[model samples]
Target: MRKLWPVILVLLIAVGLAVVLFPNGHKSLRAEKGPKPAQQSQSRAVAVEVAPAVTAVYQEDLRSVGSLMSDESVQIASEISGRIESFRFSEGQTVSAGDELVKLDDALARAELVDAQARFELARANLERARTLSKSGHVTERAQDEAKAAFETARAAVELANVRLAKHVIKAPFDGIVGLRNASVGAYVSIGTPIVNLEKIDVLKIDFKLPEAALTQIFPGQSVTVEVDAIPGRTFEAEIYAINPMVDVNGRALHVRARMANPDLILRPGLFARVTVKGRETRNVVMVPESAIVPRAGESVVYTIQGGKAVETKVTLGRRSAGMVQILSGLEPNTTVVVAGQLKLSNGSEVEIVQTQSPSALEKS
Candidate 1:
């Protein structure tokens, strides 16, 4: 038992010495055998095609798909409840402002006006008598004042009756083309009930969405070419009239409005149109090949060659034209970017520029 105790004591002393000398001995051994650093893992040079991100004149046109609208569109409706007595304008007929389009039963409105006129005449006579008597000190000033107020009230009633009678005859609010008729003769309709559609189509408007960034790039009066699908092979000219002040939060875009003239009465509202805005003024911009852009996690990234290594950079992309894309930000001009073999490359990866090429030259090829 004593011999065993000496062996156990010696083992315990050795174990205590090891713990005090190497507190992380196992960790050190594991570290020595662990995977290599990221750089060493990608030490082999990946063969890739390279292109210089050069400064280029960017004047690409802004194109959008949109719909045409009427310069003025309205759902023609009645202002008062009445039975439709007659339709003055035929279906699909052109109408001018103040032209009677529909007539309702105005018998009640005329009777009301006549009654109001009678009362108005009586009130005027009473006011005149009161004023004469007041001047002679026969009637009190209070009676004269009451008579004057009564006269004014009757006058207002007459005006009100005229307004009501006018409502019985519906007129065109503007020069426009009338759409299909909804009500027949003697069909009763209430206020705001749609009778037909009136559209000012001599001049047309267009509505489309554009990137919010375009707010500063575009302006009113910019010329654009519009191609309507219904009318093939014909390009109509249009002009930007306005831009919406508010931004669409969900789409992050701006609503743009434009106007187009239809002198021959050819172009119309409610037609699908493809609008191509004229190119902007020439300005220097950083451009790279589209192949350089790598999408990562819903973001655009590019590989810039620095010291023969791929340095991953996030870039804000802009207009793409002729196989090249504009780098709005996060990249500088004259920087070398990888155009090919990007799929096998990672950040800090060693690369060999197997072929140096220009994006524009390659696109032409």
Candidate 2:
């Protein structure tokens, strides 16, 4: 039994050694007779066309909110107190300057004019007869003088009547579109009561209030661009017509006006608009690709190619458009910036420029 026990122990030890060393032996055997090579991992670098960084001249653009308004907006009111006899122009109708719009009962005016004309004619005849008598010494000089004064008075009355008769016909002050009529035919109207609203829309005035700091760039006759949210993809061009000389003390803003031609009359008054003022065109500024500007925290950063390695650089940026941004400071012209393949980069990280392109790499040439 003792001899069998030693043999059993020996067998158990051999089994344990085989189990512990089997995997390692198998690995060594495979190494001696190498297995097939593993496939390479796919690269993340995205292939993109690139160009050297260059300076770009940009026109400084000022953005602000504005509204479309009529060049001349006014509420037409009745000048004389009387009932509206008839309307020559209807609501939403276009009228020309001096075109009759409303007619008031001018029967009295007409009668007054007729009576004044007859009086003038009678006075003229009397004066003629008196002059002839005076010339022949048939009438006294005082009588001739009185006849002359009567003729002048009669003529003055006729002129005054004609002036009042003209007021009975209300004419458009300027070429414009008529709004809703407040008074209808046979409706009594008092002096200074609104009859209709008239607005000249051939040229629209865009009014906007902007920060007073922008006043430096605002001037009369400067070119401006306007956009309305309601009309997307459409932009209107205008010229700055005027800028208020004073700024509002409460809002700290200045009023600016731009004139836009509305030949088709597409723009209407009271429509909201977004305005862009083209200030002085800035020249000789460095431009970098938008991708190169990396936003970190509240600031933006970029990687510059320095000493053949990636270097962290903080940049001051301005006006981003067309996939590019203007460098206000912190970067010089001719500086090489890594636009693509900058995600995996760190300061002084070793990078191999794979012309084949690997998106995972942080350095881009």
Candidate 3:
């Protein structure tokens, strides 16, 4: 036991010496830890593509879908019910106002009118004779008064008969082009029944809607470019004449109407049209590539290089055309904006601008 105690004491001294010399275990066996993840990321730079903001002539225009309408449209119908006796205007014919379009059976109306005229003539003669007799004291004053009243009633009847006879023939209310016939000759038609369509298409109207946000960008008498798929590769110019004051709550849009000349008759109503409402042109508008914009939290943002770091910047956007967008605000001219590799960027992040475009190249004509 004594011999073992000496051996144990010597072992304790060696262990104490080792502890004093090396506090952390053997260096060869120890695991070496590298730099912290956050520290490493902070020291590393994110590679990104950038472009300098530039100025150019820019126009912000609104595009909307609409339908073309005739300047004046109505259905040719009879004012009185009768059988169609004849049609004075041919289908697809252009007629002037007051040109008779259709005729109906007016025999009964004419007979009644003739009867009314005869009665009116007789009453008038009796009235004259009654007054003459009253002056000579041959007829009583009451008899003369009755004859005068009868004469007035007969005259009214004649005028009413003439009006009825005139309604048997339907006339064009305005100068217009007539559509296909809805009723044939000898077909019975009632009042207000659609006989055919009449449209004043010498001038055409276009009806469309625009977002309520664009209310300030439009006005009456402004010109709009319209294109129809039916007539491809051609643009029809129109002038705005009306804008509805009320905004649609459900769609947040405004109704607008424009007029255009169709003297050539190249375009027709009911065609789907695309309307371009051009905004006022402005030179030297700040422009940037559309790819540089990043949408976040329902707002637009751009990553600009500031002090060799990516600074998340909020910006107001204007009209976008081609591959570019207008920077209405939030960025200075000639500022470098990240166009690519923005997905790896954050505010205050160190960035390496691998490729930067010159202002002239970015704003090239």
Candidate 4:
């Protein structure tokens, strides 16, 4: 038992020494083996496409859809009911102001006018005779007064007859192109019956609605560019001629009207149009490709390559146009930004730029 005690004491001392000196010894040895090869390989450069931010002349423009109209449009109609005697103008013909378009039956109107003229002449003679008799005091004052009143009434009747006769002829109110004639020769048309449609297409009008927030940027005489689907690849320049004072409550938009010259008369009314209202031009603004922007949570960010590593940067954005975005802040001109392969990127990540493209070229892509 004494010998066993000595041996046990020795074993206890050795075990305490091992526990104190080798605590976590196996874990320490495993850690010394280093990280996995896969983890080490992940540190290698990630292939990405890069582009430099550029300074450009950025013209802030408001875009909206609208429709085209004529400078002058009206539905030609008759003011008086009558049977059409003849049509002086053909369908779709260009007519000038005061050109006779339709002539209604004037036989009854002319007969009435003739009768009125005869009565008017007789009244004029009687009035002259009455004036002479009144001057000589041969007729009573009451008789002269009655003759004057009768003469005035007859003169008014003649004027009324002339008006009725003029109603038989319908003339072009303005120089315009007439649409298909609705009334033909000998067709009876009542008052307000549509005869045809007249549209002055030499100058075209465009109407568009924009959000009320853009009201400060738009005004009369501001120039705008109009693109029509009917006329592909062609853009027309127009000047804003009028703006509605009231805003549409339903849409919160302002109504605007612009005029463009259509000397060739190729543009017709009711065509769909895309309107772009040009605002102030900002010079030396930093612009980046839209692909470079990474929206994170509620903020926008861009990955820029600095010192061979990707540095995530928070950016303030401005107006976006044509697949490019204006960077209001957080980016400098000529700074290279990662445009592609940003999904595999993080802060301080090594990046290998496989392609470097111009901002404009990136926009096209």
Candidate 5:
């Protein structure tokens, strides 16, 4: 009876263990069979902004910074020394060619001219009398020759006096605007004294330099665009009228000069200018927004939507202008490209175009 008591005690312990482990085994089986909570699916399509690669006329231009200059600029200086009797032009006045600007005291010059004229007349009368006497053999040939020589000398002296009198008046060399007067009336001025500055501002000259390699693209009569910092947001059209034949030895650059019409005289010399020389026109070029380009591993790339997925494409680049880039190759006309949201994209990325921008809008970006 004691051994049977031990067997009963062992049986009770086994049952207790079974009771404790049954629920855990059932829970594990249910967990394995239960439909796993559907994995949270990732959003498939990436929202992106797109723009079309369009065909447009693209111009290759040479750009440079330079300065504005007058078509003709000169410092007005006195040619002869004298006291200014009167000023015919006011400061900052416009004058025509040959218009008198200053008048010096001509009293002495006038008197000298009168004396020369009187002497010339006396010499002429004497020469006539000497010729008449010589024809009748009343005067010797040598005496007649002396009289002729004296008359000729007096005539030359009279012409010299006239030139001296004209020098007393200073005239404008060309039609131009005069700067502020440097001398006042009654102020004595020496030769080469600065009177004023004269500038022909009806047309302005733009001087700039470009690399000597660009010489083949530049020529006379080519169109140029000029922008001034003083007058922002306005571009002036000009033409290349002159190009320096020799390249600057120090800079290895070719100097170029362009001309722009300024009938209103708004543009002045010495202003800073930005110049663009239009070189060649390429028609039907594939152009894309600058934002579309992604430089990777030393190559430029853009994403184009193909089969509703982003297809990474490698593109050859050309001239860039105004927030736009010229795609020399690797893109077709009218192809749509992702301009925005490129950071989240990969090859064959599903794209949902949230917005489409116009070609002109892309250009202005």
Candidate 6:
């Protein structure tokens, strides 16, 4: 019985060793009892939403600072040297053309005219007597000729005196508003002495400087829109009257002048204004938000969505304003562009556009 018990103990140890070494065979012997792994659910891809492109007409405008001036301005000066006897018009008063504005002393000039007239009468009488005597051989031919020459000289002197007297009254050259009077009544003024400043303000001339690149577009008779800081909410329409032929050597800019009507004279000379030169309207140009413009390798580019991925596109640009940039080439008007998430975008990265209320929300999707 003792030998039988030892054999049975060895047989049990061998069975335990076999079960530990081979578990699959042991599980089959143990009625197929085993722990099973839990099955994992299938994963889903993330949903990325993208906005479709929008089509809109982009308007471009140019802004520049300019100055307004009078259409006609003249610094009036004395024509003849004399004492100013009277001033016919007050300073700052509007005067018509040919209106007498100043009067110089003309008593001496008139007296000279009278003396020349008397000398002309005496010479004419002598020439007539000499001609009559020469016909009768009582006067020599040389004497008759001398008398005729004296009469002609006297007539010329009278005309010269009349012209000198006419210069005493200085008249307004044009209809304009006069500035400050430099010469007062009873003051002596010389020829070419500045009397007052005159300006025609029924219309004003606005002048501005533009870069040489605008030379081709700036021509005579082009329309311009003008805005003055002094009078807000008012816009004046003008036409390009002139353009400088020579470009400024120092600044490389061309000067332009435009005429603006100012019937109320509200637009004063020397007032600063904002000027816009209206070019021909361009149509069907591709545009995107100015913020989407990116500088790469000395060129401008923007990321546009294509085939569900962002693609970098190089574009030629033109006039830009109002938070919009005009794409001159390499882009279509309906091409979708990355507007907001450009910082995290790559060439082929997926983009999800966040839907939010925008100014153009009412537009078609």
Per-residue lDDT tens digits for candidate 5, residues 63-155, read: 999998989888877777889999888888889999998899989999999999999999999999999999999999999999999999999
Q: Which scores higher on lDDT, 2 or 3? A: 3
The CA lDDT at 6 in model 5 is 91
What Cα-based lDDT does every candidate model obtain?
A: 0.90, 0.82, 0.92, 0.91, 0.91, 0.80
| Candidate 2 Cα misplacement greater than 4 A, ranges | 1-52, 111-157, 294-300, 340-344, 352-365
> What lDDT is reached at residue 252 by model 6?
95
Native-to-model Cα distance after best TM-score fit, residue 189 in candidate 5, in Å: 2.0
User: What does candidate 3's lDDT look like per residue over 145-170, in tens digits?
Assistant: 99999999999999999999999988
Residue 258 lDDT (model 6): 90
Counting clashing residue pairs in each candidate, in order, gives 0, 3, 0, 0, 0, 0
TM-score of every model versus the real structure: 0.65, 0.72, 0.77, 0.85, 0.77, 0.78
lDDT (tens digit, per residue) of candidate 4 on 290-347: 9899999999999999888999999999988887899999999999999999989999
Candidate 6 local lDDT, residue 238: 93
Over the stretch 230-294, how does candidate 1's per-residue lDDT look in tens digits? 99989999999899899999999989999989988887777899998876756778889899999
Record all residue pairs in model 4 with backbone atoms less than 3 Å apart, i.e. clashing. Answer: none
Candidate 1 collision pairs: none
How much does candidate 5 score in TM-score?
0.77
> Which is superior by TM-score, 2 or 6?
6
| TM-score between candidate 2 and the true structure | 0.72
**In terms of lDDT, which candidate is stronger, 2 or 5?**
5
